[model samples]
Target: EMGHVLGIGTLWDTFGLLKDFPGPNPTFVGPGAMKEFGTLIGAGQPTPVPVANVGGAGSAGGHWRERVFGNELMSPTIGGPGNPLSRLTVASLGDLGYQVDLDAAEPYALPDPFVIAMAGGGETAPPRGVMLPTVPSSVPADRP
Candidate 1:
C-alpha cells in the first residue's frame, strides 16, 4: 500500500517513532502524530498512537492497531466500503521528515464504541477512497 511505500508504519522504529516493539503494547510516539491523535479522538492531551503487536511477523510491528484505529487506511484489516487516511496518519509523515500537507489527508474518526456495541459490533467505515487491499493471510516473500 502507499502507506508502506511512504514508510509510514515501516519506518517508525527507524525514525524513532515506535516504542516497545514486539511487546504486548507497542505504540507510536511521534510528536506530530501524538498531537493529532488527541484532537482526532477528542482527548485533552496528546496521546500515543497504538501500534499493532499481535498480527505476527509482517504485521504486528508495522501498523496502527486495528482495535483502536479500525478501518483507518493504515491499519491492517481493512474491511471497507471506504477508508479515510486520517490527519494522525499524515502528521506522522512529518515526523518522518516529509513536508506534508495535513489538509491533503482525508477525514476520519474512530468509531464510537458505544455505537458499535449498540449496533451489534459492526463497523461503519467513513466513505472516502475505495477499499485498500487486505493484508494477505501469508506474508509475502518480498517483504521483510
Candidate 2:
C-alpha cells in the first residue's frame, strides 16, 4: 500500500502545480515475476473477443451497476493512491487564462503539497499587466 501511495505522490510531485518540475517516472522492480503473474491470471480467463467488435451490442446494462453504485460513493474531495490531482480553479487575468491543478496525494505522503503559480497572456499585454518588468529609473544617473 505504501508503494502505491508513494507512486501517487511521485506522480503529483512531478506533474502537480509546478509543471516545470520533473521526475516521477516508474521503475519496474520485477519484470519477469510481474509478467509471470499476469500470464498465470490470463491463462484461465474467458475467451478473447475480436478487437473490432469487443463492445458488440447490448453492453448498456453492464454499465448500470457502475452508474448506480458509483454515484453513491462519489465524494467532493476523495484523495487516495489512484487519484493524484484535481483541477481546482480556472480564471482569467486581463487577457490571459490561468488554470490550477492541485496535488491530492495522501496526507502522509505529502503533508503539505507545494502551491505553484503560473501565468499566461495574449499576444499583446496579458489580462493582468506584466507581473514584474524592468523600469527606467526616474532619478537622473548623474544626480546620485
Candidate 3:
C-alpha cells in the first residue's frame, strides 16, 4: 500500500496564482525534489544545471570587443569626390540680354549694325550720383 505508506503531508499555506486545486497536489517541487524527479525520469547528466547568471563582468567586456572589431570604420567624408577649391564660385550671369547664333549652318547672315551700335554707345562710366543711392545719411530729405 504505497499510497497509505507514502508519508506525504501538506505543510504551511503558500500563496500562488492557482489556489482552487485539490490535496497533495503541489504546483511545483523544491530543487532537491526536482533532482530526485530527474533521477527517476532517467535523464542523464542531471540535465546540466544551468549556470545562474555566470560571467557577469566578463560578459560586459564582450560588447567592448564587438564595438572595437565588428563594426566598419567610416571615412570623414562619406560619399563622392572632394572639391579642390576652399570657396566655391557660383557664377550667376543674368540673362545675356541678347544671344547671337554665330554657328548657323546656312548662308551667313550679318548682325544688325544698329543693334551693335546701340550696345556700345551707352555711358562707359557710372553716373555722378552713383553713390547717392547708398548714402542714406547724406540724403536731401535728411538734411538740417
Candidate 4:
C-alpha cells in the first residue's frame, strides 16, 4: 500500500510518533494526525489514534486498525462505504512530515459502532461526524 511505502505505521517509531508500542495499547501520537482524528470523530480535543496490532506483520503494525477505522483507506482490510479518502489519511501524511492541504481532503466520517452492531446487516465502522473513541464490548473492539 502507498501508506505502507510512506511508513505511516511501519516507521511510526522512527518518526517519534508512536508510543507504548507492541503492547495492549500502541498509539499513534502524531500531533497532526491526532488532531485530525479528533476532528473526524468530532472530539473537540486532540485524541490518540490507535495503531493496529492484528493481521500479522504486513498489516498488524503497518496500518490503522480495521475495526476502528472500518473501511478507511489505510485500514488493514478493505470493504465499506467506498473506503473514502478522508482527511484522517491526509493529516497522517502531514504527520509523516509532508505538507498537505486539509481543504483539499474529501469529506468522510465513521459510522456508529453501536448502530452497526445493532443493524447486524451492514457497515461496521464509526459513522461520519460521530466517530466514537470506544467500542462497546458487544462490538469487535479491534485495535483502532
Give the top-scoring candidate (lDDT): 1
Q: What's the lDDT for all of these models?
A: 0.83, 0.21, 0.22, 0.75
Order of all candidates by TM-score, from best down to worst? 1, 4, 3, 2
Candidate 1: minimum summed lDDT over ten consecutive residues — where? 119-128
Clashes per candidate (backbone, < 3 Å)? 0, 4, 0, 7
The C-alpha RMSD of each candidate to the native structure, in angstroms, is 13.6, 21.8, 42.5, 12.9
Instruction: Give candidate 3 misplaced runs (Cα > 4 Å).
Output: 1-8, 12-20, 23-27, 44-144
Native-structure RMSD, model 2:
21.8
Model 4 agreement with the true structure over 1-144: per-residue lDDT tens digits: 777788777788898888876776777888888898888778898998977765567765677766577767888777556877778778888998889898888767776787646655242433359567885667566755
Check candidate 1 and list the clashing pairs: none
List where candidate 1 sits over 4 angstroms from the true fold.
115-144
Could you tell me which 10 consecutive residues in candidate 3 have the lowest summed lDDT?
A: 86-95
TM-scores across all candidates?
Answer: 0.77, 0.14, 0.18, 0.74
Tens digit of per-residue lDDT, candidate 3, span 66-117: 1111111111111244311110000000011123232221221222446535
Candidate 2 per-residue lDDT, tens place, 53-94, comes to 112122111111111111111111223344322111111010
User: lDDT for model 3, on a 0 to 1 scale?
Assistant: 0.22
Residue 122 in candidate 1 has what lDDT? 40
- Local error of candidate 2 at 24, Å? 23
Residues 51-112 of candidate 1: C-alpha lDDT, one tens digit per residue: 98766556788888876787788887777578888898999989899999999999898977
